[model samples]
Target chain A: MTLLESRSRTSRSSHGGTAEDSRPGDLCLVVMETPNAPHSEAQAAVSDPPADLSHRLSVLLESIGRGDQAAFAEFYQLTSRRVFGMARRVLIDPELSEDTTQEVFLQVWQNASKFDPKAGSPLSWLMTISHRRAVDRVRSSQSSTDREAKYGASTQDIDHDSVADQVGSRLEAEAVVRCLETLTETQQESVRLAYYGGLTYREVAERLNAAVPTIKSRIRDGLIRLKTCLGVS
Target chain B: MTETNSGRNGRSGSFGDTVAVDLASGRAVDLAELYALDALTDEERQAIEQYMSAAPAAERTEFFDRVRQARETLARTFRIEEQPPADLFDRIVAQLPVQGSGPDAGTPAPPASGHIAGGQFAPRQPASGQPAGAQPAGGDELAQARQRREERRRPGGTRRWLAGVAAAAAIALGGVGVGSYVADQNDPMNQVVRAGDLREASVDVAGGGTATLLISSSEDAAVVKMNGVPAPPAGKVYQMWLIPKDGSAPVSQGLMDEEALSKPAVVEGISSAAALGITVEPAGGSQSPTLPTVAAAPLGA
Candidate 1:
């Protein structure tokens, strides 16, 4: 898969159909029937998101918390691509990811008021929901025995380096890549196996032919290094 | 042999031994990182969540932030795979329970008092009253507000949250409609099923089973619970309709939840609904009830 950095700084008038053009009730008729049709005919009805995206997203979410349908639509437009992208990676199936994406947005609409800025960034909050839903879809559709059988065979010849190299080149920030590069190769491998491959540590250990305890420490220690390097605080 | 082998190289002896140490540490900082990376086993993940339930809000938020930060940084490594299908956004908005339409319609303002008794874990009352997973409600305005503030903080299925909200609604509205008499407080459907104001009737379905129609004392709401209702054939669903006494077209309340097949669903906003009707419609449900009504329970009967 090709890697493309997300550097959207301004809201472009790309997606069409303005909020004023259609009331929610009339638009809902189209939605309930077609279900898969594009809901927003226009771009999200907001000025360009300021350089500080977290504040803008939080502002939009606050409006959504008050039952503002237009703002909810806008929030979906801003975040749905990344949300869908995460679901796609986790599930590795377009159809399942689509359904999962739909479920995540629905939850967001119903529970937007529940978002606490103090907890984390809006993207993280949103992606957390997306990842959970995607993982759920993945687990529910495939049995554990099937997953283990598949992973055991496929992961043996998997070239994880190629995956990371492709991802690293397109990352928006060189600093993130630089921080990741600081880890020892084994540390990098273990972290990549768990994070991108969506494998548990036990599964990761099995793939790497390492002890579980060794894998655990490698992952934890590597993360600490990355956190310090990235200045996460 | 399996236990001994795994224990020989496992992180802290056996899995059980590891859990003891993990919990004794008093925080799941390591586990949260693993969780964000999708690295924890199912058992380890659940244990961490339970541990998180007991942690302080600041700690929980910090843990969540760390996890999210890791995820965001890691995410920069990949690209968008594909756009979601069209009109998906509209369907999402349409499904949200219409805001400002219920009893709390005019009360969109924040609560007046800022008091809620804070607690480490927000209680979740499961459907069955067995108290198997039910936690005590963190009573007080501050706790309640905090609970509302972070409703999406944890990841219990939203269906459970919906049931809890429905029960809370039943409790709050129960006092307003019936001043003197009280509905059974245990039933989540009590708001629409007070004893004094109840108008009940039952009809036997052609295929078998029974549909019970219950109107609240104020006649503004209803609850329809079905028992042993045969599942609709493939590609079809069992739908419920609220037929008005004023000659309006039957209104659909969407498909009935399978779990609620036995548990009654509170059907609100039914001021002049004359009768309840059940039908078999296409999978997503029809705009109106179709064909011979499988069963009908007249409100006046």
Candidate 2:
């Protein structure tokens, strides 16, 4: 649809002041390869994006708030893969993941009006909601019981190699994998189990045979190192 | 326990109440990392939320910024993206209410006269006498239900408003309230069912079941009592809507989740609504009434 092309120019000019100040290069590679790789025109906009893409998403959300179905379709096309991917990572069941994906998009449609750019970038807002919904589903009583039964039949150690295999061969994924290597063994395990495994810090501590505070500090320190290495801020 | 240093334990106490207090009091900024990772329980998250709410606005903003950055960075690590099923978008579209056109376009304007018709309330028997079953069999049932609504809304077959003392007398003679629970004075179900000007109507739900609406124009509310209504399809719920007489978008009344099925659900703000409609939606409901309502009853005035 022409929605993306028409809105991108308006949003670019409107967000010029903030766009000029932010670190445009920090997330450029990551954003480029993640969700928008399938669309050729989207790839062209990757050169100076961090704010450009975020502003475009914000504008799409605003359009969706006014019940513009075309804009909603465009937004879904742009972000559904990543949303579904996040749900797959946490829920692991194909059926559940598909259901969660539907729920997340429906939520985006219903709550588009509540989005505030001042709170966070549009991708960040979307990922946060996706992660929360997936995690919530994982923690629900029935699913957790099923997971526990499944886990009891498997090894307790975090499957680091499996995670590595799941990372695509793209530059961003490789970069994150490299940053993850920089953390100590304990930090890597703690962070991986808690984030991708959808386990609480207490559960991470239980799994690792470490004290709760030790697990907490490991996650905090590990994230700080990754944040710096990835140039997130 | 003996392997740890005494100093860390001494500072935070024995890992239960003291640590929770530390988190609630805003002393545990490091917990922001766990919060970002979605690694905290609901109680832990609530404590952090309490701390953030009390902190200065700038400090609060900074905390969220930190969480956002970490979360975004972690999100990038999810490199393998899977395109959702091809039919998923169509299914999502199915859940959105038809807006600004289509079936909603040809409805006549609401009557301008102020007062409602004083005719007797004629309780129509449900078309099918079968009990509400499990989930709806399939889309065929929904299509049939929509056809029934279309027939009812046809120009010449417009539903007439029926109300009178005789109808109120009939309701009074029907001994028990809709639910088995004792009707407390403050109960919403009691308030509407016991109102002086209450009107009642029942519509057979699509798959198999009945939904009865008890309306009180004086209270500007209605209570929906669902009987033998099939559970919504997996991962979905029945959402109620108030269809305005002016043909604008329908306003959502609320959702009837599985647990809510047996009980009477009170729907307020019915004064401007010309009809009540029920649609099966994704859990948590949709912003508008999804087309092809499972059932509908005119709130004629």
User: Among these predicted structures, which one has the highest DockQ?
Assistant: 2
Locate the minimum summed-lDDT window of 10 residues in model 2 chain A: A17-26
Tens-place lDDT per residue, model 1, B1-301, is 1213232223343222253365665435555566777677677788778877888898787677777667655544333333344334534544567663343321211111111112212232322321111222312232233234334442332222221321211112222121123334444355454333444433455464555455663747766656456677777777888888899999986575343354456666666777777888887889988888776655532
The list of candidate 2 runs beyond 4 A from truth reads: A1-52, A141-169, B1-19, B24-26, B97-301
Best prediction by lDDT: 2
Cα shift from native, residue B175, model 1 (Å): 66
Model 1 spans > 4 angstroms off: A1-12, A15-51, A144-171, B1-20, B25-27, B55-81, B101-301
- Cα lDDT of candidate 2 equals 0.59
What are the RMSD figures for all models against the true structure? Answer: 20.0, 20.6
Query: Best candidate per TM-score, number?
Result: 2
